[model samples]
Structure formats: structure tokens, C-alpha cells
Target: MASPDGNHRHPETNGEAKPPAPKKQKLSTSITDSEIQSEFSHHDASVARINNGSFGSCPQSIISAQQRWQLRFLRQPDSFYFNDLKAGILESREFIRSLINADDVSEVSIVDNATTAAAVVLQQIAWGFTEGRFQKGDVAVMLHYAYGAVKKSMEAYVTRAGGRVVEVQLPFPVSSKEEIITEFRRALERGKENGQRIRLAVIDHVTSMPSVVIPVKELVKICREEDVDQVFVDAAHGIGCVDVDVKEIGADFYTSNLHKWFFSPPSVAFLYCRRSAKLSDLHHPVVSHEYGNGLAIESAWIGTRDYSAQLVVPSVLEFVNRFEGGIEGIKKRNHEQVVRMGEMLAKSWGTQLGCPPDMCSSMVMIGLPWCLGITSERDTLKLRVHLRDRFAVEVPIYYRAPKEGEVDPVTGYARISHQVYNKVEDYERFRDAINKLVGDKFTCASLSA
Candidate 1:
């Protein structure tokens, strides 16, 4: 039998199948950096990939496992679909449930990504609004910096259904966690003062553009106190970036992308719907034969698609265990390396970090030197293209227009991501590339021309 980690394991001896062995714990000591980098030799060594946060790079072993599954499907579609797919998905969910400390396997459903999960939850809530469970002008609170897709999802479903969206304007380059908590609380209270009942709150585990770790758990607790009807955590960068204990957080619904930081293939994420939430009202955005059934069954078969990524969760978990302290150790190493690299870049550019070290996870947002003339989102995009095409450096450039009462009129940042395969030289390459561009007097206008 093919094992999750691309190894072969004998499941039968003397024509009798053996019981599956329990997964072993992670090793205490991790492999060397060179050895880790060797796992992704398939990638282009010429390009410095420092944007692992956007779309994670899978290792060759996991790719082999996925290809094996694909070949198995192609060999005999009937046997693969009838006998293998459902079991494989359930097995994947079981592993993820344990990883997130979810109370039951039923609470977790595998979907393409966090966007689909958001649609599932928001559509259900929209249905609730239609049924008169919520009044017109009911508010759905979200941070001003929530993922763009998620905000669009809420606007489409909630706002169009007689509900309203209220944004909590979180301070950028924030000084402390207390500031975030205070702002969140104030948003909820201010909405209530305006006679708008805050029906829901969408919180991020980590902000994408600015790449700071949010105090989601504390925010959830505040939601409970504020009597917000429901809370959904868009933790797209959650699973491998930090220790996510879903049950401990006690949010009504939470979704995270396994592909972002969990070493899974692209387009696979898990949504956790608390058993106590309105499960009967929730349904998959794509209606399948299992529509009336629970979300786990409904989401499992969302019309014939690439199910290989979802099936390889066991293999992903196995790959994670190969490192020391498992995901915990990986996160620790990534955080330390990313912070050091971020500081290095800030010093090299004569700029500063967007937030403190503790406010970040495996990614950090470092201020780009203002001399580069990155003044707007368009400028950030142009500079990003220039960096990728000219210097073969892949990093995210973000621009934050100054909000009211801010010191700086314009702010630009480079959000750098760190993963197991990354080394100091990769970030140094980025730093040197930016320095050269600045030294060469390249500006956003020059790139545009």
C-alpha cells in the first residue's frame, strides 16, 4: 500500500491485512537547513521565493503522493470514486480535526479554499436575514483590513439581503495587542450606539497585506461579551502559522487554508462549523446530491474536481511530523528567521518594521524606503512586477494610504514570508534587489513607463 508520505507500507501479510499503526510523534531535533532545502529541488534556484504566505510550495514527496492518487483515479475511475475518494476525504478531515483540536470530525468540512467557506457561512446568514431572524440594517462587523475576497463575500450576501457591513478601523503599525482589543471593542460599542445591532464579526488570524498576527482568541472573547450573534474567523494563514485550537477559541464558524502554510497542495482548506452554531441552516454554496445532509457530506462531493489535494492531507501531516516539534517547531523556526530577515531589511533600507516581533507570525511587513516612490496601491503593484521580472525576487509589496490622524501621509511595505526551504541568502537577495533599484533611481513611474 502507498503511504501518505510517498513511502510504501505493507498492509497485508500471509493474505491477512494488518491494522493501521498509530502515527508517531515529531522528532526532537530538526533536519539541517541544507537538507530541508534539498526537498524542493524541483523549484527554480535562480528565483528568490520569499512569498510562501500567498501560495505555499509543496515538497516533491507530497507532489509524488498527489500524482500517485491522480494516476490511481485515471486507471479505474469507478473503483477510485466509489471506493477511495470518500474514505480519503474523511481520513483527511479526521487528521485536520485532531490538529485544530476540534471536538468532533463532523465539525470540519474540506473545501477548495477559504473563499468558498466564507460563501457557505455568509449565504446561510443571508438566508437567516431573509427569514426575518435578523432585522434590516443589521451590521456585520469586520476589520477594515480583512481579506478583500471575504469583504466582497459579506457585501454580496449580507448587504444585499437588507443587512449592513461595518468596518472596524484598526490602527496600522499598531503598537500593542491592547490597542487592537480596544479598537475592536470600541467598534462594537459604537455600532450599538448608532442603533445598529451587530449581528456578526469576521476576524483574521493574520492580516494578509500587513502580515501581523491578530489576537483572534481575545477578539472572540470580546465578541461573546458584546453579544455579537456570530463570529467567523477567516484564518487563511492559520494552521501552520500558529497553534490554532478551534474549540478553545469558541467562535461560531472558522475557516483556514491548508495550502497557505500547512504544506498542502493549492486550493484545499477546512471550515469548522461549531456544532452549537446554526448547522441546519448552513449549506454548501454548490448544491450536490447531499444538499439536505450535513455540510461534511455536502462539501465532500462538490461535483467532479481535483480531489487530490484534499486526499493528501495524511501525507501532508506525515511530512510535517518529519520536522522537530512538528508544526510547532516549524512555526517557531519560521517566526525567528522571518523576524531576523525583516529587521535586516528594515536596517538595510533605513526604514522600520510595521509591527513588533510578537505581533507577527511567520511573515513580517517591513517599511520600504520612501525613496523608491511607492505611494499608492498601483505603485506597489508596479514595483512588485519590476522586482519579479527584473531581479527574480518574489515578495509582496503593500501600500497603505494614510488614514485620518496618522503621522505618515504615505506608507509602503514589503511583506516577507519565511518557510522551511528559505535561507538568509533569499532575503538578502530581495534586500540587494531593492537597494539596487533605489540606487539606480528606479521609481514606480519609471517602471510604469
Candidate 2:
């Protein structure tokens, strides 16, 4: 099969390389609001999408590229799937490697999403434990603020393998990086005292609920000093929001969702296995023909699923690069906008920011006053529905649980996401809507009292 670069080679047979294909002409960088909006077909113009963090919005151009690949798959089926797909996917892997500054393209694999990538790594670790590579009482360290689904996956794997999960309690409205590092060190030391081997530490580059950027590099350093065997950096919200250098962070495994920040279609993400980690035993959750072929091929063709999302990555990069200041510029604007919006909302709600400004990225968690009556999960859900239904504003309201066995009051945060499509007026509208709701609720409670 001919590669995307026009080099002809067969996976089953070795052959001479052909001349590279002509590169596609670059699109003009002059993009307007209307043009950009038009490119995002999935955007609901009627509703203010302040919740880009939930599921990323893709550009229409990238969607077009995905469609083109889908059409090719539909037309050729066998030839495209067997011959052409590998080259395109390899190219995409290289793009991902460059984006995150990975040491080599071989270290990267295109997975379904960050969640799937985490599952893959956990499964491999579980296998190792069962095969006696890891002991029964080994510890898998995690933070209390990890994405709920990921935490559950880690627990399932560790428990099934007779290993225990050690959760480092991280406070909400976290004050400083040192506080987190200190807590993690305590957990590591405690594990050591108990004669348990700390095998894997799943750290988030950017946490989900509280929306704070964890000091991953510092945490990695701590893990190394404490003799933690492996580190998995869950960077689901890291890539486009903040600067991510996997090579520098030096985690054993790194996974991030390109769909969330790179403006690609959903169900697309990348996983990086550092060469020194020697985790070549890792495979997709499902075994297929490409099983044991190697990480790149094993992850690339996982059960003949649609490769449109992976194939569209190049276009997504190109489209995002054409943004006003490129990826870094886009991140800068988003961070500034969210910080401003968070400050405004926090002031309007008469509450403090969830975390310091330095810890925030494109997403900000603005504390919702306790008086707002959104203390329970049901209450938070109702508030979310109210914001969407009454104000046409789509935003996530997170209810932070009190520490285990603690009697502290539950806190609420309106985690707002800022992207190029969002405007200052959108956040102002959200602020006004929330203020009215909280004010009315407080008045009613006062009357009842």
C-alpha cells in the first residue's frame, strides 16, 4: 500500500520506498469569527457553549477531512483498511509526538480516548501483577481529584490483581503546589512503612472537577525519589490548554485527549509510552490481528473500527495552527478569558476562587457560594438544567465531596470553559444568570427561616 507521503511499502512484505507525495497547499490564515463558526458544524448557535471541557467542539474543516477518510473506507473497504491506513496513522503519530515533544514517534499510540488509554495501561499492569512481575500487595497511587472514571478503572485493575489503591487526599480550593507534593510524600512514606511496593502513580496533568493544573513534573520527581515504579500522567485536559512536554515530564506512560483541546472530532486521543519504561507488553483492551505486532500497530488497528478521527488529526493541527496566535496564542487567550470570567463570577457570587490564578488553565473553577442551595448532587444537577434551560448557558456545576468520614459542608463550583468561540459577553450572561438564581434562592431560604 502507498503511504500518505506517497512511499509504497507493504506491512507483510518489504519493498523500496517511492517518491514522497506532494504536500497539500496550506490554507490562508485569515480566519474570521463567522468563518470559524461556520467551520464548527456541531456548535449550537442558539445556546452559549461555555462547557467546551465536557466534549470538545470540532472545526468543520477537520470534520470534512474525517468524512473524506470515512468515504474512502466505505468505498475500498479491504484495500484501504489493510494497505492505506497504516501510513496515515503513522503520520498522525508523528504529529502527536511533535505536539507533546515526545522522544520518538514509536513511543506514541493513537487510542480511543484518555480513558481507554488509561484502561490499556492498567490492564497491562494488572497482567504484570498476575504474572508475578508485581507482587500482590503492591500499591497504585492516585489522587482524590482524579477523573472519577479513571479512578474507578485503576481501582478495578488493582483490586482484581490483589493490589491496593493508595489515594493521596488533595484538598479542594488547594492553596499551593507544595501542599500537594507534601501530601503525596506522606502517602509514599506510609506505603514504605507498611512494606508495600508503590508500583504505579496515576497523576493528572490537569484535574477534572476542580480544574487545577497539578505540578506533574514536581510530582514525577517525587515519585522517582520515593522509588515509585511507574507513573501515568492523565493529561485529558492538558494539551491545548497548557504547555505539555512529555519528554520533560518523564512519566512512564502519558495519555491525553486530542479531541478535547486540539479541536478534533470526538473519540480521539494519544498515549505515549516512554522508551525507557519498557512497557512493550501493553496492548489495547481488545486483542486483534495486530496483537503483538508492537505498540504502534497494536494500537492503530484495534478491531477494524473507523479510523476517521485518527486520520483527521493532521487537518486538526493545521486548522488550529491557523488560529490567531497558533496553539500557544490560543491557549493564552483562553487562559486569560477564563481567569477573567472566574474572577468576575467569584466576585458576583461573593465567593473565593477555587484555586490560585497560577494553577488555572483554560478552564477555571469558580466557587459557588454555599448559600446557593446547590449542596447535593441532585441540587447541582437541577442548577445545571436551570442554567441551560432558563439562561441558554451550558456550563458544568461540580459539587466537591467532603473528605471521607468528614462532616465538612459540601462545596460547589461552576467550572467554566473558555475557547475561541466564547466571548466575554457569554460569561457576563452566565454571571448574571447565576447571581439571580442564587439571590432568589437565598431570599426564599431567609423567608423560610
Find the candidate with the highest TM-score and give its number. 1
lDDT of each: 0.85, 0.81
Model 1, position 277, has a per-residue lDDT of: 40
Model 2: per-residue lDDT, tens digit, 163-208?
Answer: 8888888878888988889988887876677788998999999998
lDDT of 1 at 114: 94
Model 1, range 1-449, lDDT digits (tens) per residue?
A: 44345444342322123334336555666666676777789889999999999998898888888988888888888877676677677767878888898877778899999999999989988987899988888889899889999989988999999988888888878779998998898889877876878888999989898788899999999999888989999999999998799988889899999998998888799999998745657889999877877788889887877799998988888788888878888999899999999999999988888899999999999998777777778899888888899889999988877667855444789999999998789999999998998898877877654
Give all TM-scores, in the order shown. Answer: 0.93, 0.91
- Name the runs in model 2 displaced over 4 angstroms: 1-28, 401-410, 442-449
Worst 10 residues of 2 by lDDT: 13-22
Prediction 1 TM-score vs. true: 0.93
Error of 2 at 63 (Å): 1.0
Model 2 steric clash pairs: 5-21, 39-60
